[model samples]
Target: MSRGTDPYVAGAMDRRIALAHEWDELVERVRRLGPRFASFLAPPRTQDFLSAVGDGTAVLINVARECHALLVTASGVTAVPLPGLSAAEIADRTERHLTALRRTDLAAQRVHHTQQRARVRKVPATYQAHHAAKIEMAEAQAELDRTLLPQLAWLWDTVAEPVLRALGSPARAGAEAGHRIWWCPTGLLSFLPLHAAGYHDGSGRTVLDRAVSSCVPTLRALARAARAPETEPAETDKLLVVAVQEADGMSPLPQVDEELRLLEDMFGPDRLTVLEGPNATREAVLGQLPQHRWAHFSCHGRQDPLAPSTGGLLLTDGVLGIKELGARAYNGDFAFLSACMTAAGGLSLSDEAITVGAALHYSGFRHVVAALWSIDADTATALTGDVFGSLTRGGRFRPQASAAAVTEAVIRLRNDSPAHPSRWAAFTHIGP
Candidate 1:
C-alpha cells in the first residue's frame, strides 16, 4: 500500500535533514556570542570554531533522541517494517559516510592553522560517549532499512509507476574508451541473492525475467568485444571474473548460462565454456579464473562489517567466499559480477575486502563495474542491456563509459518524467 516499505527510512532521512538545519542555526547563534576564549587567536579559526561551537553539544544529543523517537513512532504507526542493515554492514556504510563528514570537519581545521585539533573536544568524555551513541543510532537506522525493506516487498508495489518507463533516453554518440567496466546483472530478487542457488531452490521463478529482455543485447555487446577486430583487453597475470551475488544463497549459474549461450552466438560455442555442479567449487572457479580473458556471472555480492575479505557473493557451491580468496592479489584481464552490492568498497575508514568489483580490480583486472546499492532485477535488466549496448553499438569498450551510460539513461528517464531517484541512482560505477 505504501510507496516505501519502511517509513522509518524516510523519517530518519527527514530527521537528519532537520538536524542539519538545527546545526546551522546553532552555528549562527554561537557566532553572535563572540569568539571562543577570545584573543587575536586567528580570526578564521575563531570563526570556524564558533561555527561548530555547539555541534559538540547538540549533534550527539539530538541524534540519540531521534533514534528513541523512531523506535516509538515505528511502533505506533502502520507497523511498516523498517529497512535496517546489520551492525557491521551499517558501520561499514555509515562509518564511510561519517568519515566523509569527519573529513569535512577536519578540512575546516586545515584552513584554520591555529586550531591544531578537532573543535569537538577530541576527548573521550561523556560528550564523546554521546557522539559514539549517535553513530550507533545512525548505524541502527541503516541496518533497519537494510534488513526490512528487502524482506517486505509489498511495501513498494504501488510506488512503482509506469509513467516514466515509456520515454527512452537518447543514446550518446562517439567512442570514449578510458576505463574498463565489468557489469553483473540480477535477474530478480526479493531479499534473495541473485547469484546464489538458493533463489532457484525456494522461489519458483522471478517475475523480473519477463519484465524486460536483458539477455539478448547485453550478451551480444560483450560478445562483440570478444569479436573485436583490433585491440585486446590487457591481461597482467590472468583474467579476473568477479561473480557477484547476495550475502548468502546459490550461484546464479543457470540464468547466466542462457546469456552465455547468447555470448557463444557471437564468439562461437567452442571458444565459450560454462562450468557447473561440483565443478563450480571454489578451486574449480579459481582454476578457471586465471585462464579466461573475460568472464561474467549473475549473483549476489556483499560488503559488510568484521572484515572485507569475509564479504562475498553467494555461489553454486556454498557462498563464493571472498575472505578466503583474497581478490587484491589476483591478476586478471576483466570480470563482471552481475549481482547486487558488488560495488561497495570499505565502508567508513576501514579498507574493506575486495568488494565484488574492487576484488576484480585488485585481482589484477584492468576494469570493474559494480552497483552501489540493492537494485531491482527488472531495473538491472534494462540498465545492464543499455550499458553493454553502448559498447556493442560502436562506443569505446571501456567500463567507465559503459557505467556512465547506465546513469545517463536513468537521468534521461528521470528528466523525461521524474520517477523515484532511488530507482536509478542505486547503481554505481567503480574502479579506474
Candidate 2:
C-alpha cells in the first residue's frame, strides 16, 4: 500500500496505509454489530471504481486547495497538470461570481415585489412603476456578465483547456459527439460552473463543445449510479410534471403553463401527469415521484447557503427540500429541474455537493438537468421545450441522451442571445 520512490508520492502512500489500518480496526468493531455495517464501512477497491465509470466516461476530481486535477478513466487515474490554477484564483473567482449572483438575485426579487404590488392594486404595471426595478435588474445582470465572462475564460485557460488537451482532445475545435465527462470539483471550484468554462469569443473552444459535462459529489456516488438497475429504453414511459406557476411568498413562474403545455403535447396525457397550481403539494409531488420514470419541475427554487437541506422547490403548500427527495429510493431515469439554483451547491459546503440535483441523482435518477443559478423565466420555458422535444424525438423518452439534448438546447439559447451568458449558461446536465 506504500510503494513509491518519490518522496511526495511515498508520503501520500504512507498516509493511505495508515488510513487503511484505521479503517480495518473500525471495520472489525462494526462487524460485531452487523455484516452490513462492516461492508458499508469498507473502503473502495481500485478495480471496482474503474469498472464503474466504464470506457466512455472520464472523471475529473478537482481536489481541495491548489493541486493537480486527477483524471480517472476506465484504465486508471493520472494527475493532470494545471499550471495556471491556484487556490487563491479559484477563491477570488468564486467570491466575485457569488457577489454578482447575490446582487442579481436581489434585483430580481425587487422586480417581483413590484409586480406583486401592481397585481394587488388591480392595475397593469405603468412605465414609472416598473422602470426602476427593471433598470436595477439590468444593471445587476450586466455586472453578473462582467464577472462571469472573465471567470469562465479563466477556468478554460487554467483548468478545462489544459485537461482536455491532455485527454487528446483536438486543440483546434470540433470534439466528437456523445463523449461524457463527470466533473467532481471540490472546494471553491464546486460553486464555479465547470461545464460552462470557455472564452465565448466565437472560437468554439469550450467544455460544451469539447464534451458532455456532468457533476458528481464523490466517486462512490458515481459507482452507485452506475450500479442502479437498468431498464429497456421503451420501459421508461411515464412523465411527472410538477408545475407550480404561483407559490405562496414566491415569484410567479408565468411561463410554467406554457412549459407544461409543450411537455403535454410531446408526452401526451396518457404518459404525462400535470400537478400544477393548487395541486402541486409537497406530499402529492413526493407520492407521485416514485411512480414516474421521468420528472419535470417548473417552479421557484430556493437555496439556503447555511442550510442546504432547507433549500428546495417552492410548492403551493410548502418547500419540497432535497433532503426529503434524497431519503427516498427511486428507480427513475431522468429529472428536469426547470427552477432556480437546483444545481447550485452551498459555498460553505462546497465539497459536499449538497444540492437538489445531487439529491435526485443519488436517489437513483440517472440523468438530471438543472440550473446553476436563477434563470430567466422565458428562457427556461423555451429551453424546457427544446430539451424535451429533442429527448422525445422518435415519440420516445430517451433519458440517456439528456446531456446531448441540454447541449443542443443551450447552443440554441446562446445563438439567440449571444450577449446574455446568464440565460444560456445557467443550466447544466449531471449524469452519464
Best by lDDT: 2
Tens-digit lDDT track for model 1 on 1-432? 268568888788889999999987776776667664332322332233222211111000001111110111111211112233233333343444434333433333232322222344565564555555456545543444343333223212211111001111112111121112122221112112111111111131211211110111122223323332333554322223333322232223334444444444434444444654444556667777766655655565555533456666666566666655554354444455666666554433232234566555555544445565544455555555555555445523444344345445544443442223333444544332
- What are the C-alpha RMSDs, in order, of all predicted structures? 24.0, 7.0
For 21-87, candidate 2 gives per-residue lDDT tens digits of 9988877887778754655666877776687778645556455455677888888888887778888
The most accurate candidate by TM-score is: 2
Candidate 1 regions exceeding 4 Å error are: 1-266, 276-279, 324-331, 345-354, 394-418
Worst 10 residues of 1 by lDDT: 56-65
RMSD of 2: 7.0
Quantify all predictions' global Cα lDDT against the true fold.
0.39, 0.82
